[model samples]
Target chain A: MAAKVDHAQFRLVIPSQTRYLNLVTGLAKRASLVAGLDDATAAKVSIAVDEAVTNVILHAYRGEGEHSVELELRFTEQALEIHIWHTGQGIRSDQLVLPDPKEYIKHPRKGGLGLLLMSRFMDEVQFKADEVSGRNECCLIKKIS
Target chain B: MADLSIAVRHIGDVAVILPAGFINAHTVREFEEALEGQVQQGRYKILLNCKDLNYISSAGLGAIMGLIETVRENDGDILLSNLQENVFAIFDTLGFTQLYRVFPEEDQALAAVAPERKA
Candidate 1:
């Protein structure tokens, strides 16, 4: 008999702490399982998901307690999509730059690598900031095939 | 959540520390502490067996870089072996493979640490 597949959605709240990256990683793992992704693909999804959530926690919230972040994961037969929404102040997406490997390795900066990793691992990564809605959204999509 | 564990073993002049599980912010400190303790004891040559290490974050990689600097400042070196492909990708993406001495096996790492002296 073929394995039955069903849609799954999970919502998790992580405090604005670096340690919370683990929580995001775990959630991505679960999402991968639900989406029936292979081991390597699942790992890539996990890394990309963690990077996206970490950006929200670090940049959007800045480890502050005033804002809470929500991670919503959706799984389907075709793909797995993760949405990270935060109530913290929104920043212009165009301002973010992909880390140049040469410059980063030479200087070894602390931040900015998160977005690079996310873009490298995910099939589709989009950042949307809505000032009027008071929420910043980062969407990551990975094909299960 | 991913858990990090460390095991330290001594082999000749080198100390082989195996860190298993995920290397993230929660575990980065412990990882740093383990290496710092070895450095404090004057164990300069170290081999990190990452065969069983399943995951590593940027913070974890940064911790490794910090430890390398710490050990090198005191005339020590660290070699990494058995890096999984996923971990290798992270290293490659961050351009760490160019900076660190990475080996395919523990023996290679140990040999790199203590080269044979010809008679």
Candidate 2:
């Protein structure tokens, strides 16, 4: 599927819990198709969505009571983009700690692949945090074929 | 309802786990419990038939990875078979084929274990 003019946009707001992760993924799947992603690309985009949103659910709340994550899915002619936002502890882009390739292969950690998956499958990835608002956002983009 | 369901069948000494449903952070606990239960029963040779698994996240991957050490320490292996494309992509991206053997068919995974079981 190639890029097209105009895009479809969708939004899903869910509580920051593991159970709600699928809700966001469902939106991402729709966005992928709207972006004209083929089966393979759609699968990657969906998985990328799962990873990005899961990070927010697992890390954003930080013990805060009943926080919600807001997800925005934008399907553009050129890309399928997702913005995951939460008003909790934020990830400073400078402090992004990806798994070390050498060590990861030597001994695959029980966990720690979320960031890697997001970065690998998405073409453009950005992380932002606002100290004043305490907003943590992850924007991931997958280019359409 | 949980997003995932795991049904286990004892095939000789191997535990065949049939997981139906997309697996993610919300549902990985069920998968972990099923695998852990096999470990608890001293049955480490695990074969997962993902014929019905529509999706898998890194967390879901972690659930399986978490149990590998225990299974291997007991001289057993984890074999994966019948993966949907979406689920297989995640496993492939993680280089899981190196950690566990993946078969194109469930019977193949079972066949590989049969020799080991008989020996």
Candidate 3:
């Protein structure tokens, strides 16, 4: 992975609002397509990136005030790597636990499915946060087929 | 910032909400409000025409899910139509396909909403 740092990286910083989520997802989709992805794969990258950034805007910033979410996409020969950065309340690992699809289907809830979709669409998902700096990063990687 | 805009139409007893733009956290509130208005008016049978919708995520799905029981309780249902392939994938990925009725065409969804009525 270290040797693959030669890949081009595109960074987009947008206001942490759900409306701006498309800007990030669009970038991810186009970045993936430019990196040699098929239409379906590009769509997956867009959806996954959309969900990740939405969580930051809704939960991290708690949907209030003005904040910025930076989305960086790196196109390596083998993968499309995405990183999202924000200064908001970072989620605990346990918070990512989602109910079984059957459970939600039986008794539908309005939440607890973002992480599931992200994990399902992307090949790799990771979270890193610094409590002191209040900065959190969500990393998503999808291997090129 | 892209906002979600909802257009309302009445096909007999059903309320057809034509949503345009992105449906996510920022816009789900407005989405819910639109549903709430319908729910308040006792218009429980609803159909969402997503032809102009550019995008959607879990937040938008959640909003739709939150209102299901209420609408069903009123002997009505909220069905979706004209889901772009990419948008439909999210629903399929999340197992919403089994929970909601998703159609390929707006007229098909509207027809499904009220089988007794004419388009």
Candidate 4:
């Protein structure tokens, strides 16, 4: 994390534990605000980042032995970009289909909901996974209006 | 992160759950268990008084989704009341406001479920 307010860049690394989710979300909220996003957009970005980080901990590092999740926040002239890196299982966005809330309640699954919310809240979402290198990355962007 | 605190109280047959603090992946288990406890006890008329709840992630919402079917099957429904504006926005964005009934006040929500208790 940089102390330069004008640059507005941040980097955080947390162990793959759910306990640190709040710290990640707090930084996301502050970073989004510092990047000149409004309160509503900042809140959404915070949630998207939280969901992204939560997925890394719960799904990417499932059953893992003390892994770390790397997160980077960059504010560009056009958008606020958040990148998350993990060394566990990768995510397939093609397989993630957002379900209707009414229909979803009938089946009610715990998985995929976080990703679905992330997709809805953020302006752009991209995923890259290297099965051989065990490096998986997800990037979420929210454009500045 | 402030720990999630849940206090369950009864308003006639309705079991009101008051959860305060953030409900992210870390604390979702406690929220889920509290809801489950009410269901297991066969008390299905649940009202979530979220006046003091500051934040809730998808994991928290999933807990409610996981049990809605059974609760409705038993002729009981989970009603939500006193949601903070930010919390309500999350529910609305996910189309939950349409699936579940939400009231501005706890009294209004309880009256909808326990109409007989109305004065």
Top DockQ prediction, candidate number: 3
lDDT of 4 by residue, A1-145 (tens): 8565643567888889988888888888888888889877778888888898888888878835399999988888888899899988887667567776667656566555777788888988988887787799999998888
User: What is the TM-score of candidate 3?
Assistant: 0.89
List each candidate's DockQ score.
Answer: 0.40, 0.64, 0.70, 0.62
Residue A4, candidate 3: C-alpha displacement in angstroms:
9.5
Which prediction has the highest lDDT against the true structure?
4
Candidate 3 regions with alpha-carbon error over 4 angstroms: A1-5, A92-95, A130-134
What is the C-alpha lDDT profile of model 1 across B1-119, one tens digit per residue?
Answer: 34888999998778899999988756778988888788888998888899999998776777777767667777778888999988998888778888789999998888777877111
Which is superior by DockQ, 2 or 3?
Answer: 3
lDDT of candidate 1 over A23-115, digit per residue (tens): 678778767877888777778788888777666666667757556778888877788999888887565558677889888778764556667
lDDT of 2: 0.82
* TM-score, candidate number 1: 0.83
Q: Poorest 10 consecutive residues of model 1 chain B by lDDT?
A: B110-119
DockQ of 2: 0.64
**Winner by lDDT between candidate 4 and candidate 2:** 4
- Per-candidate TM-scores read 0.83, 0.91, 0.89, 0.91
The candidate, 1 or 4, that scores higher on TM-score is 4
Give the Cα error of residue B6 in candidate 2, in Å: 1.1
lDDT tens per residue, model 2, A1-145: 9876486777878877777667667767766776788777777778888887777767777534388888888777778788888887677668888897457768877888988887887898899986788687889888876
Between which residue pairs do clashes occur in model 4?
Answer: none
